[model samples]
Target chain A: MTMPDSSASLPAAASASAPSTKLHAVAPTALPPGVRDLRLDFFRGLALLCIFIDHIPGNRIADYTIRVVGLSDASELFIFISGYAAGLVYMSAVAREGFLFSSLRVWRRVWQLYVAHLFLFVIFTAEVAWTSMKFDNPMYVEEMNIASFLSEPHIAILEALLLKFKPVYMDILPLYIVLLVFFPFALWLIRQSRLLALGLSIALYATARIYHLNLPAYPEDAEWYFNPLAWQLLFVIGAILGASTRTFANSGMDFPVPRNRWLLGAAIAYALFGFGMQFLWEHDLISRVFPHGSEAFIFPTDKTNLSGWRLSNLLALAYITAYFLRADSPMLRWRVFHPLIMCGQHSLNIFCLGVFLSFAGLIVLVEFSDSLAYQLLVNGTGIAIMIGAAALLAWYRAKERMPRKPAEGPAGGANVKSTALGGGSAE
Target chain B: MTIFHFSRRGSLGWRTAVMTVLLMAAFSPGADAAEATPPQDLAQFCAVPETVLPNGFLKHARDAYRAGKPLRIVAFGTSSSAGTGAASRADAYPARLQADLQERFTLPAEVINKSVGGQSARQMTSRLEDDVVSLEPSLVIWQTGTVDSVGNLQLEDFGRALSQGIEMLEKEGIDVILMNMQYSRRVELLVNYSPYVDMMNAVATQSGAALFDRIEMMRHWASSGRLDFDNMPRAERASRAAKLHECIALQLADMIEKAVRR
Candidate 1:
């Protein structure tokens, strides 16, 4: 694994949330500090849940469920949110800690992300390799070992070290880590002023479009489901939103309208759009344009460029979600919501686990599904294992009573708390 | 006197210029007369000599066996015509037909394979000027209708292209011979296309072009157990069917020999 060898201090931002766990620790308040934004938590949980169903492997129930709920590809939404969230975190860092310190913090996270990435590679690779060897499928065997594992020694080393690969909905971690590298710069521009950041982001976006820049795929098999350069716009937009929470707070994320009317309108409009796009794609209009769901066209599932139609649909969903977040609903206060919140709060951990479970589950289920009853049993067992793993992590975190510690600063750790308070005050 | 002389000279020049203009107008094309006479059958324009055979088959057959000149033949159609499934271009039935024709007639024949891949009769008809009519071919063996049937083009459109194609070739004085498409189970159901093949044959009958029934010939071979259906490789079954196809092609070549001999 190619990992960058760099260690740097990062100042803490945001006072740690109350970490009391005297009870069964069932409350959202029990989670470690530095992670706020309850709405983001809800979405993170929702995205993870959708990913669970999408990767359940040949289960009619999961497929039907995902298709019905429009969670078949919650990855795009999650990635866009990731860009948004990175902006939220790093922009605040740059505002309080100065450019150099914030840049170091971004680098540190990228390192952590790369570390997390190697673990993902091993998990997914082993699952695929094991499954292929057991089932005796030549394609899978070649794909898991010779093609993916050993195709490009140099590039793989570079990816491991720099944490770079083509950004795709599937391989989002590399995309996220790569985008994080630019966040400090993005945030610095935002601090210099929003107009400057906005201008640069647009310029970069246009440049990406004109040049048609894209990440290189694996040399041997050349599979790409995402184009990072095209997707960077979404990330930058997210960063911009994340940086200026005051706007969202003041206007309640642009929801100051009569809540019920806007929610109803958004719901109906989004439904119509989604259904219309799905119909066109099914009947084969968009495919005629690009023929293979390429990101260049303005159509459904063009997640990379975030086609206007998809973006508008997403905005509509965001509005509907914002309404729900503000309004009273059982989903907001349910005991079940707490576990989701825990999973959502510690998303990096949750994502890592979800990736492992899904990869393992898919391989095992695909093999077992030949037998009807065995298929159902396998799916049931898979779901149970996922829940069990989430429980295990929650239990482990509770036992440790771990708090998110601010990085050791060059001047000292005192600078970290001041940075956090300063950011909090600004918002 | 001077004025009279200059007037006389001007009159002479004017008269001479008027006479020249009148002569040019009589020979030259009128402005209203359209110059772009849309491509009339250019094959007839290249009037090549035909070998005249003697009265009886016995005499002409003997001459054919002894003919020293190479026979010129042209074949046209879609992918199958292009010999897509043939193990090699050499194995393509057209090449095989040319070899057979050369051997039997004792003639050094050059076969021009003008087959293009994935072309419907519509496309072929559109390009007839360039591919067939331009060659002024002694024998134009047309193999079409495979794409016509499969591509679901209107039967009327197919008929129009076929009629125009035959008419254009016949106008060029090219001895046109059409080899109808081979049989496929898929096409037997489509009445529109299957009947269009017959329409093509009727056009040939009307236009006096020799009609080769390759479809019927293949059926005969299939019934006679000459077509190796069971023993052939699954992928090669289609190619093996070309044996029957080649027989039809060779039979057409014989007809062309007879026509050219005449």
Candidate 2:
């Protein structure tokens, strides 16, 4: 019944270090030793694939994604993994380099994310515009909700630059950028006390739900699809776990998280309940028990505000995953699982690529046939391309680390080969 | 130097010839007419055929119009009918149609929008008793098939829901017009809407309901180059959409008027 202790299993090199105030003193290399966690990458990669499949709208394969069987979809998994990784990376930076330097580092990453979002925006708009013109169908632009940009370019451009006019599939990154901008404060609070940070996050989520607080969208008088106010709770919870693992490594003191049989049983029960409800809802059978208007106040699991049901379901799923799926599990070491690990390592790039690929998949589905073979072909090709891109990126990054010399090619290649085969630190 | 001289001269001559053809095509009268015709004014731009409506359609609306009583028509469907891309509720097809009908018949016409966003035919069917029939409308323009097709709902199930929904409305002696999915490149690329489109037409014919072939009409405008949705400048997209809605309304009005006169 014991919850898996991530800190207890850390490599000796990681646990040997105590909290230090010169984080940047250790030069920023491609990856720090003993920091890469396969578990994080594995789940993140899985989430990215689910997101890609789900975005195609009507693909038959989407039914197999986690959303059909669970209340919370890949969004929760993606954001949670991001937070966990951030906690590990930034908290270590804060402990080693001190708050000011680490905060700046976090902010720099935020800037990168913001730039990436804008880049995606430009490309997505162009894709829609070009396709619309080529096919002589204006509805593409409108369907993607970029009609505003077309109708009012000046104002639309200004609002988009401000991260206010996010179209479909483009909304998530803006929310992520906003969250990362505030990551430093969250990390600082967690460092002070994990419970304090968790408490504040829960309070904020509750307030948001009660008051309907959310950021506004530009062009459309609607709130952000993923309300940061509510979603920050999941992010903070992940950060706490991530930071606690690091804290245990530095101070040799574990965070007090009860891992009793009752807790495990409760988590299992809740997860089963969620799965059952999701199944019933999918079949349109749940209405028999919870008649439409009767459960109006309590029903219809809301994703935007991260409703109580969704949050609980996600927590249960997370608990089950943590309990069963250890980093050192033999199942994870299989050749088939390597792609997920690689994709997760290069998540940002793969995710961006996946978005475009999914759109292309959509186009193929619409223009071609909606037969099972076509759906499978489009989805399969898109995923294979994603996996291939990740592998190439991994190889390139590995190559960069090798010492340069014409005669040393075989030795350098061997080292890179071993790294890939061994599945060492993902970073 | 000799090779460079010949290549450069030949390239310049080819470029000049291509430019000359392009210029001629741009200035051609037919091309200019198609491109320049403002799509906003349907009466001016659209060559809508007379009697687009089926015979014996809109009997209730006609009777109401003749008796000088207010004609009630419900524009019922998913987001398009509810007006997702429209500038305003007034800019939606139903509103435009209401305005057109009222002006043409010289009688008060009320088009209630009972449409919901993101609802499939099945979901709409479930709400028919409350949303559509309960309103006691003389005519109901049901825009359907898009959501079901995009959602990948079973074709048989979709057909059943549509048939059931139409039966419920018609049983109340309401004239039903089945508006098929909008023709959009994005939608065309995303889902195979052909099956749903074909099924909708079959259902409309079998049920004796007027089929508003919106997709066909839109395709006509697009193919004729009367509306270049893809290449249209961003500044004019809103106006373009507004005009498209107005055009749909005008066509719908003509269909209703023709049916009533017959």
Candidate 3:
């Protein structure tokens, strides 16, 4: 480990205001650790919330999500930020402990994800089946694509263990598991040359896209919903950005951005175009003008294959965000985002909980009322529960981190505003 | 889309015989003579082109109906076919269709609804043998794609299941009429039904099945003021659904008549 005591990334987000920064590999740790860029937690947290909303059927909250303003949805940001966090943490691990130990840690996390996926599958299936039976609606099993599981539990369980029998919202966790398997090698490549690593990742994505290559699923010829082969590009792009500091400045700490007006203008223009196009895609107002569906081509934006439109849209938006909302922006540290940051810090737990809550929310909406006021109430209550759970988990973890029981420790609410990034973990 | 003729014309082999009965059946009192008055009169709902070309693929069903045998049909779909929103099961499109067909013909007609609410095309495909084909129905009116679109399921999966189901029915010499999602302008922004609709059309075209295009047909109703769906109150859904199902039955019966011979 090059800097075992120091983080591979910035020591704290405090250096986000510096003019130039070196990779943690070069920087000496002179300050306290556990600080991460608030943006990662903020955006990742927002993406998690969007994912919860999107998972539920007939969730109108989804209309106001990333789909409204960009071709890329929250799924992209979730994967990219996951890679970003992995790179920020594990790249340093590899440098410090060599590939073998770092890979062991990665595998441990992957095992956790695999277990989490199966656990979710069990809960999601049971809930759907119970709801359907309780309501005397057999189609609920079909809706979640768990009919096979219900019909042939033995075969379906094996297939699910192989990560082939993913019902609707269970695809992302499996993809994450697959991504972590190759992280050791990918991180090694990134350490040698970020461009070469990213270039190889893009090449694989291109080949996958061109050939329509993806892993097949169980009991059906259809491939994985979020094709990992193509999706690795986004993760790699984020990983390289996370692993490498800004190269333009060498004197002082710098945020991971290369500011240029032309690039900024182009990014802004593309993002605006995507926003307008997405608006049209959702409303389908453009079809009305043409009357006979003349020249009204349905955009071939394939989510499964991670179409180029979505990729470019995500990259453009990321750039615009980085250029305008600097790492040290006051909004990043806003008190309003505390709960979100807490949610982000304990993302894995919050994500699993959120997935379950979404289904519960759906059941409530179905069993009760789905009117406007009711929907708002359901959404508000669901999000509040997620936040509250996140805060409690964050508080518990903070207590576990301390060696002694502090006599003057603040309560959970007070600690929320000052909650350190990455869950206050120095590791 | 071959126009059925009520007037006598120089007859071709099958055309001469088909011309005598189908045309009269097509013009059956329908919306124009419907007992309801003013807004309730379903004249505007029946304004669509009645001959949907489902008959081009209805060779076996047409022959059965022509032989004076009891014509049987299975209404397979989700909530809409299962009679959701309507006042009662009889008020659903399938039950109303049986009555509509009986009124149009002297022969015994049965329309069995094997619809399970909230099911997708995938589920319908699985139930093809047990619920629909086992009944030995000559025709299957499959209402699908709504739940799939609403739940954001895979388009390819939906298309594949739909095509497979249609192929199975076609292999059994069953006429298939593919009905799409119900239209609600309010959720239009929330759900992308276009891809599923397009996929349905593609599958129907490929399999030689007829597409009812319920989504567009209802959209047409909304735009033309034939129905007021967007501003409809919760309490009004029951009555409106009854009328909606009745209008659908009327239009479908009209289409069925245009394709079959007496």
Per-candidate TM-scores read 0.49, 0.61, 0.66
What is the C-alpha lDDT profile of model 1 across A1-427, one tens digit per residue? Answer: 0000000000111111011122214444332324356666567666776666555433355544323433124666676567656666665566557779868867877777778887776444333333333333211121123224334445655654544432111366777776777777777776666556665666676676576555655432232234566666656665665665433233222222234464457566775667555555434354344434252233324444444455555545655665556422336567767766555655676677676655544433332221334445544554455556667866785455324343354554445544443332111
Clashes by residue pair, model 2: A23-A96, A23-A97, A150-B234, A366-B189
Tens-digit lDDT track of model 1 for B61-142: 2343356545566788665656665555566667877876777665577678888865667788877888877865555678
Best by TM-score: 3
Candidate 1 — which residues are off by over 4 angstroms?
A1-35, A56-59, A65-72, A91-99, A127-170, A220-224, A247-268, A279-300, A327-330, A370-380, A402-427, B1-262
Off by over 4 Å in 3: A1-34, A135-146, A246-257, A289-300, A404-427, B1-154, B157-178, B181-247, B250-262
Q: Give the Cα error of residue B92 in candidate 3, in Å.
A: 7.4
Q: Can you give the DockQ of every candidate in the order shown?
A: 0.01, 0.06, 0.04
Q: Write the per-residue lDDT of candidate 2 for residues A42-125, one digit (tens) a residue.
A: 888999999898887556798899887588889998888788778866776676679998788777777877888888877666
- Better candidate by lDDT, 1 or 2: 2
Please give the distance, in angstroms, between residue B245's alpha carbon in candidate 2 and its true position after superposition.
Answer: 15
What fraction of the reference interface contacts is present in each model, in order?
0.00, 0.05, 0.02
lDDT of 3 by residue, A1-427 (tens): 1111112333332344343233343446422233466678788889888888887656677789777878899999999888877876676556666889878888888898899999998875565444333332221222333333566777777988999877657789999889988888898898777657876897898899888788878655445879999999888777776665323223222335455577678888988988877776566444444444332233536778787778888888887887776444567668999988878877888899888777666555443334555567657777888899999987797687564335436664334423433223211
Question: Which parts of model 2 have CA positions greater than 4 angstroms off?
Answer: A1-35, A135-146, A249-256, A292-299, A404-427, B1-73, B76-185, B188-262
Clashing pairs in model 1, backbone N/Cα/C closer than 3 A = A2-A160, A2-A161, A13-A420, A14-A420, A84-A238, A87-A239, B53-B261, B70-B108
